[model samples]
Target: MTDPTPLTSLSSALADVVARAAPSVVSVHSHRARSTGFVWKSGLIITADEALADEGEVRIGLPDGSTVAATVAGRDHTTDIALLRADTSIAPVRLTRTVPALGALSVVVATTRDAPSAALGMVSVSGQGWRSLRGGEIDARIELDVRLRSSQEGGLALEASGEAFGMAVLGPRRVLVIPTATIERVAAQLETRGRIARGYLGLGLQPLRLDDGIGAMVMNVDKAGPAAAAGIRQGDVIVAVNDQKLSGVRALLRTLGPASVGRVVDVAVRRGGEPTSFRVTIGERPEA
Candidate 1:
């Protein structure tokens, strides 16, 4: 085999890329209900799918000691992309028409780690898509290795020349940042909707498996919130919402949609050993 090229003397150009893009990178944490009656925090960040993944009370720590609330604006499942909003503002990283070639050197940064971490690696693959274990296939994704840590999700990865190439999302030690261009398109959709917000029902649910049906079994209810006010109680089997059958969490999200944000809706559940219906007015998610 021929001798390999020296990496250290590559060029002055590569150094500039890391310096320019690292600041814009961020870390995200999301909270979900668990069987223990407590909330658990996890990260599956990157700029995409911001709405679905709970980056609970996002605290973006900038290099300049600035921390701002990062809100989930919108997400397009077809493309697996989500947009986020920050009040302090950032000098949005610029993009290029050209994509990173295979084996291009890049750096990834996690702004939300217990102690921030950085890694150096090369793009092992590009223009690839994978079906998420969560469902839905993400396309035009770049796969690289930057020695990512647990909280590195939703961080930023940059080309050696500093132009933003993508944002980090997943893998074990391998990192994948969906291309920045795709993120821009989804952010546009979020902007049209005004601000990023989520709704809360204050009910805990467990998936029910049955031969002829699919549903969630209510394990607990927020007694002081909408679910309790509407007569929802633990042990209720939610079979449907507003006429639409509930299949799973994804289906439940669609049923809520954007229209549910302040409107009262009918919820069908099996309570007290009998089928029942109740109307609950959806409530706004608390500001982080």
Candidate 2:
């Protein structure tokens, strides 16, 4: 063999990082499908919500080659995350507080079999906190320049130093890193409430162009829903919610967070060229 080379040294270091982080990575099985997850807390595992099958039991295959039963504690489909409570204790991975720099080397680790699988890639994009396309708040926006396999949807993303950036999920056209802050916040809520309670107005809305910008046009109203009871009729343009200007459909959705449910709020609308307002009671979102 050639004398010790820098390439060899780098390979050795990567091996060590994988060895140390593999214990926290797990294979999640739901509805006869397999994905990945990492231990979040003592008995909680976080995975991509979309990867889980809707009709079957959930289980976790640990790194030690044993499997344990798991239950879906809660899921936030807006962010595409799900929390599972494992029957046995687990070693949670160390999450890095700082955002990873752009173009930095990173690895995605998954526990599909007895050993961990890793994919090396660079941080293709990193930016300040933002919201997903669906209106879910994310702490940091990160995208990896790696094509993730179907089995690695919920794997852990780590920096070169073995510090975890977050969990990886496939977005509409790219792979996204679901930052640790989002994970922790959603996990805590799931652990406490077992579900995310979101407020709903029960109106089918479409975006309409306004001279100022954009507004939501009420296309249909549920006769028995909150909006209908508040006299919000079709053909009305919602201008604002609780004093916040409504620019588009997403803005309205963001305003109706979980805390807004079951609370009375003012809705400003324009009907027939005249401005009107209604005091509407926000209702809990119905099950899908």
Candidate 3:
């Protein structure tokens, strides 16, 4: 046997990761009602927007078993990330990196009042887009491919090297963690103004279905809308709206909604891969 024993302990890496990340991982308990007007309770601690479908009150249970009331500070429905501030002060996890490039190994840990669950995976792609949460939608999302357990939905997603990446967000079958890079950017805005500011494009656009490959297609450009005003055509295959790149239908929706009107954002698209650009002056989005 080549050295039956090693000097370092077995759980060293895990222990280090936990030590650095545990403080930020909080236990979220929500008060949702049963159909009968009686409270039939189910619990999930969230660091993601799905947990805050409607902005309201929630009880955050700390690792030390102290529970404090937290209010929804702000929510980016398009990105599926929500910010919650405790009624009392607690130490927060500092975020360092915002983007997880393709092939980056990362770990996810979710804990209930009982146990903690962990899983590992690599970043399949790196980009911001949108996703649907319980009652709302998330935009400018950072998508990942880690397969998350049912218990892992509201937990933390940490990089293998022990940095806090983002919170374990969601997907129907895949684990989507919000990259902390974007979170810090939005959180600053939320902390200052109580909400996230997004650049909006006025018209509704759909993903273009093509025989060659996947891309975004514009179904309609609202009359006198941002796209119309900017001279964007109905058949435009949106490659990039603003700084975020577009790959398909999902990308287009993620970029369009929640974009603030009057903000000037760029739109890069490929009309048959020829590559064109537009200066879109986003207009106001009507209230839902």
- What residue runs in model 2 are displaced by over 4 Å at the alpha carbon? 1-3, 206-235, 242-246, 259-266, 279-288
Per-residue CA lDDT of model 1 for 1-288, tens digit only, reads 665456644544555555565555544434531100000012112354532345456544555655556565555554456555555444555554356888988776554443345567888888765544444344466888666555655556667766556666665456776675655544554566633344567788898875558878888888877889998989998888888777885666544433457878789988765889999998764544
Report the Cα lDDT for residue 231, model 2.
95
Compared to the true structure, candidate 2 yields what TM-score? Answer: 0.85
Give the winner by TM-score.
2
TM-scores of the candidates are: 0.51, 0.85, 0.60
Off by over 4 Å in 3: 1-10, 33-46, 98-104, 114-117, 121-147, 198-260, 263-281, 286-288
Candidate whose lDDT is highest: 2
| Candidates 1 and 3, the one with greater TM-score | 3
Q: What's the distance in Å from true for residue 47, model 1?
A: 3.0
Q: Compared with the true structure, what per-residue lDDT tens digits does model 2 show for residues 144-237?
A: 9998887899999999999997999988788999998888887788899877788889999999889976779999998989999999999999
lDDT for 245 in candidate 3 is 63
Question: Which of the predicted structures, 2 or 3, would earn the higher lDDT when compared with the native?
Answer: 2
* TM-score-superior candidate, 2 or 3: 2
